[model samples]
Each structure stands twice: as structure tokens, then as C-alpha cells.
Target: MSLLNGIFPKMKMTRSSNQSTIVSLADKEYKKDRPLVKMCGITSARDAAKAAEAGANFIGMIFWPDSKRSIPLPIAKEISRKRWFLAGGVNHMNVCEALSILRPHGIDVSSGICGPDGIQKDELQILSFMKAVHSVHY
Candidate 1:
């Protein structure tokens, strides 16, 4: 089975160390909160829907073909109701223009947010990217 399918099983049973069982996502009830969250590297619509139902503020669909997590535009478009960001190769240089065109609720980045090593996440780079994103009205 695919990673997405495994992550979003129809019914999941979790047993705690105390031997208490936790209800599945389908059976659990929740009180909503206002924190905005985004699920990145989603490859399937089913997973996207599950993320939306679980209260994600945004879902990320990586469009860069080079990334293993990339999802096709058609599949990404199939997911609706929840705001989503297109990630992969997104950086400060093109973020504003991409935001203006895509108009997603937010954007996501992995490599673009990394430091000189191109792997480790850079706090300063992330902050700068956020500032750039916030500067755009839309």
C-alpha cells in the first residue's frame, strides 16, 4: 500500500502504555481551536480530506516534479473545502508572485527554508520568508 493509504487507514486502534485504548480518528470528537496549521508533502486527495477533517488550516501539495512528495495538479485541484498551499522549490524570490497568482491561504517550503547545507531548516530564512509573505496584501 502507498504511504498515504497507510497513514489514513479507515480505522486505527492505539493502545497506550497504560493499556488504555484511544479511539480512531473517525470515532474521536474534538472541540475546535483557532491555531492555523498546514500538512505538507501530501500526495493523495484522501489524505488531504483527512487533514481537512482533522482541522488543518491548510494542506500542502508539492508541485515540483523533482520532489518525491509532489502531487499532480489535477489531483491537487480535486481537493476542496480546505485552504491549501503549493510547496516544493518555493522561495522568497518567487513567493510574492506565486501568492498573487495562486492566492492560497498560505505557502509552505522545505528546501527553500533551509540554510547553506540545503537540508537543515534555517530559522532566519524561515522568518525572512514569512515576512515576505506577509508583505503581500493577498
Candidate 2:
């Protein structure tokens, strides 16, 4: 087996001790305070549906071919039917163009937010994008 495969024990349920079980329950209650948004790049539609059912506010569907999370627009459209936010590749230079087409509730961008390897947002670009969206009637 591959090193990654061996390390993860595919689809195996974690055996939680009593203390761990109590911690998990407590964590669930704590998470109720703020809506958590999860970006799933490695999950199938069924798994994404489960996340939606569990109260995820956003579900990302990668459209960048270079990413392992990349999925076709058709599949993304199909899986994005639930109430959760649907967002895909909003990092490319043509992101605004794509947004015009997909019309997702919100767009997510990381690399596009800054220079390569940078950790912060490019304030000017961010403001421009936000302003543009605000100008739109929808």
C-alpha cells in the first residue's frame, strides 16, 4: 500500500475512548455558536451532502484543473443544489467572468488574494472585487 493510504486506514471508524467521546460531544455543542463553512476538495457528492446535512454553510467545488479537487461544472451544479453556498475556482484572473456564469452565493479566493506564497490579501484587488459585486443588482 502507498504510504499515504497506510497512514489513513481508508473509511475506518475511529475508536474513541470515553474521555474522547465526551470531548467530541462537548465540541459539537460549542460549534453551534458560529456557522462553520467547510471547503471540501476530497469528498464525493454523497459526502458533501452529509456535510450540508451537518450544517456546513459553504461547500466548495474546485474547477482548477491543476487541483486534485477539480470537478466539472456539471457535477458541481448537480451537487450544489442544497441550501449551502456553492463556490468553485474564484482565483483565476478571469474569476469575475466565471462568477458571472456560475452565480454562486459567494466566491472564495486564496492565491488570487495575494502574490504566490503570500499569506495576506491584496487589499486593492479585494476592494475592487467587493465593490464590483456590490454594484451588481443581484
Candidate 3:
């Protein structure tokens, strides 16, 4: 098993499952009024700043060359101080370990929240993902 799967074995979900079915095994309840939200695949400084202004807890810089949303390192550095997360193919499976290792202010997601089309962000999936993440005590 991959290291992430080993660390967070419960993150896996079948494609047949509904968006609401994605759950986490976190035993602790997050009491915070709102967990930090990080929007990934930011391509421009204007968009990055806009996300920050819109109350996004963190911005994500995509460094993976395979990702359509990937940005150059220089651009990433420009917005490095804006409370950001490094993201590309981040998902529920690796999020727990990523949080454990990086311990950033928040985590970001993209394809994880998308529908089968892999483009449109599904509201139900987003809600479920958020719920799972927020359920973590840490």
C-alpha cells in the first residue's frame, strides 16, 4: 500500500458511490466555527489576491507539470506569503498525511471535488469533503 493509503486507509471511495458517501475516519470533532479553506490551481496573481480577499483561508500553487493549472515557480514565489498550500493532485487519500507532515494552515483540493467530468466542481462532493476534513479533531 502507498504511504498515504497506509496513513489514511479510510479515504478511499468507489466511483459508484455517491458524492455524499465520501467519509473520513477522524475520531475527534473539529470545534472551530470554520475550518480553513484553500482553493487550488491558482494561475494568476489577480486571481490569487481575489481569493484571499474573498476570505479563502489559503491559496494553492500547482507545481506539478502534468496539471493543466500548474504555475511557474517564480509566480508561486510571488504569492508565497499569502498563506498558501502546495497542491496538484491532492485528495482525501493523502490529505491526512499531508496535513500531518506539512501542518499548514489548511489543505487544498481540486479533482477531489470535481464530478465525473473531472472539471465541474460538485457541490455535494465539496460539502462531503469539507465535512470529512472538519471532522478531524486536529
Candidate 4:
């Protein structure tokens, strides 16, 4: 708590389930000099990059099970970068194509990199999958 002592009265980005954007409840002193913006439910890096490009100071990764925008861990990590966020039916077999054609903000995976039970993440599959993505030129 001491870390935030001087900056304790910080503003917060409030959100609701059905919304894609964040609303910062200010403390009157909030200035346009660098308003804090957190782009929520970012599913790709492109979107994140775009948000960053637009002056967003932070990002929110969506992973709520019942929320329509819930993203898989692998995909979230992928987009947690600067650009490109791709999802929907992506897997090892087709990741290369997605990267070559679509490009990264990052890829979201569930069954694509999961074990047989479709719950636990398969490490080798995750590695191989990210390797395939990283191998792409652009």
C-alpha cells in the first residue's frame, strides 16, 4: 500500500459486462494531458496496438466464462502484445495460415492447444503452436 501512497487517489476504469469500452471515474483533477484509458476485452494485438495508438494507457484482458468476449489464455497472451488479435476456430493446423494472412496482435486458443479433456492446456501443443506463430514473417 505504501507504493501507492503519493498516488493513492488514483482514478479507476469502470466497466459493465455488455460494454466494450471503459469509463474512468475521475477525481476532478483528471486532465486531458494523458487521460487513462483501458481498452477492455481486447481479443487481439492489433486491437491492443490500436488502443495504444489511440492513447490508451492500460488494457483489460477478458476471460470470464459466461461473458461473450471471454478469451482463452493463449490468445490473451498473444494479443497482450502491441498488435493483432485473432480468435474463433484457430488451432495448430491453421495458425501459420492465420499469421501469414491475418498477422498478430495475438491468437486465442482453447481446444486448439488443450489436452484431450478440453480443459487443461497441453504444454507441447502450446509451444508448438506459438512456435508456428512466431515463425511467420509478418
Candidate 5:
């Protein structure tokens, strides 16, 4: 990631607790008040739809061949129903505070909802995290 960061110093790279990276190409038009929300580490269409229904601006499917969180192309195709990330250490517990304080144009999340083994995403946590994001209105 440092190498990539060196090459693209303008890009912001976020790494999850599990060491998986999520990179975001931010646009200047992003709104600080109603920021875009990106949910990463999605492996199922169900989760993708859930995030969208919860009002996520984008959903990211991991494609890194080396990461356990990476999904297969077919599954990725299926989840193309939604799209996009790269933020780290975000979860249900602290996301609200982060959003309220930083007021960023968009958010990137990943292992924030992963289970103890850091291999599987927790559906309940997903809900909690989304709900928290929704609760913070500007």
C-alpha cells in the first residue's frame, strides 16, 4: 500500500483490521452534510441489497485474489446490483462519532463488521452500522 500511496499520493488508502485494503477515488462534489456511504466486504447479494435499501450510496465487493474477504467474479457480478470504498477501523460502535466529527464527503468500511475470526461479516452488525449512519443527520 505504501508503494501505491507513493505512486498516487493524492489517493487515500484505508486498510481494514484484517489487512485488506479499500481505496477510494474521491470527487470534489462530495457533500459533507449528506455524505456518501460505502459498505465494503460484501460477499452476498442479500447484503448488497440490504446496504442499498438502508440508503448506502455504494457497496463494494472484494476482488483481491489473496484476501479471504475477496469474492468470486460471479458473485461480484450478482452484487453489481450496487457499487464502490477505502476507510479503516469503522464499525457500528464508533461510525456515528466519526461521521459527526469528520463530516467527510464519503465513508469506507470493511472488517468493521467481521466476526471474531475476521473471516465472516456479521449481518446484525451490518444492520447496526447502517442504522447508525442513518441516524446521523448532518
Candidate 6:
């Protein structure tokens, strides 16, 4: 019987579930002036270093258990720092969770944001994902 018990009755709460009002990258804006050069399918520390050196604005490391690209948290965190922004998973649901956990500059999703057999992107989900990204200041 906590203060938020009924308000979010079904919420699966965790230490990282709470939202913070403290915005850090408020001054920065996303611009195509410097394109979002992302390194997808980052598998190792070497790959992350290479992507960082290559001037990638983001690097994706899969966290989805089913994906071949998935890497351990320790390895992923090691690759992720102040340098290249880390993106996790190839699914929308996991991307959202990753956002809560990693707080990466950007998020990347493929299958979960798409329809069966990668037919098309779901507009609502895409918008929701983008909104989630915009809500947090990097």
C-alpha cells in the first residue's frame, strides 16, 4: 500500500522505472547538419572503438535475448560511455526499456517497430518511440 499503488496498479516497477525532471542535454538539438551516423549491430568492444573513431553519433548493441547481436551488460556498458551513444535491441519494447536503463542519446529498433516480415513501420509506435526520446534530454 504505497502512494502510487493504485495510480499505476499494474506497473512493474523497478529502480530505473521512475522518471527524472533533470534534463542535461537540453541545449543540444538533433540536426541533420551532422547526420545521425549510427553503427548498427555492434558486437564487441573493438567494434565500439571503431565506431567511435569513425565519428558515429550512435552505436547499437543488441540486448534482446533472441538476437545474435545481443551482448552482455558489462561488455555493452564498457563500450557505452560519453563517446558514442548506445542503442539497444532491435525491438521497440526493448528499446523503450533500454531508454530507461542506458539513457542513450538515441534508440534504434527494427523488427518491433515494423510489421510482419518487415513490411512497414508502424506510425504510432514510431511516433511514441520518438516522443520517448524527445522527453529525455540525452
Clashes of each: 0, 0, 0, 14, 2, 0
Model 5, span 1-138: residue lDDT tens: 242222221224344587644433323344445644667777775675566556566665554456777765565554452124324567888778756654444466678888787879889888998999999876
Local lDDT at 89 for model 1? 72
Cα TM-score of candidate 1:
0.51
The candidate, 1 or 5, that scores higher on TM-score is 1
Measured against the true structure, the TM-scores of the candidates, in listed sequence, are 0.51, 0.57, 0.42, 0.41, 0.40, 0.55
Candidate 1: C-alpha RMSD after superposition: 12.4
TM-score of 6: 0.55
Among residues 3 or more apart in sequence or in different chains, the pairs in candidate 5 whose N, CA or C atoms overlap within 3 Å are 22-86, 59-83
lDDT for each candidate structure: 0.63, 0.51, 0.57, 0.58, 0.58, 0.54
Of 2 and 4, which scores higher on lDDT? 4
| Candidate 2 residue-wise lDDT, 5-65, digit = tens | 2221111112236422110111132233354555557236666645545655456667767
Model 4 lDDT tens row, 56-88: 545566554566777776766555433434555
| Model 2 steric clash pairs | none
- Cα RMSD of all models vs. native, in order, equals 12.4, 13.1, 16.2, 11.4, 15.3, 13.4
lDDT tens digits, residues 60-103, model 1?
A: 77777788887665665554323566788788777787666556
Q: Poorest 10 consecutive residues of model 4 by lDDT?
A: 1-10
lDDT tens digits, residue span 78-115, model 6: 55554344444445445545665666655556666665
Predicted structure with the largest lDDT when compared to the true one = 1
Q: In model 6, what is the error at residue 94, expressed in angstroms?
A: 2.7
Q: List where candidate 2 sits over 4 angstroms from the true fold.
A: 1-34, 42-44, 86-88, 135-137
Q: Is candidate 4 or candidate 6 better by lDDT?
A: 4
Can you tell me which runs of candidate 6 are displaced by over 4 Å?
A: 1-36, 54-57, 83-92, 131-138
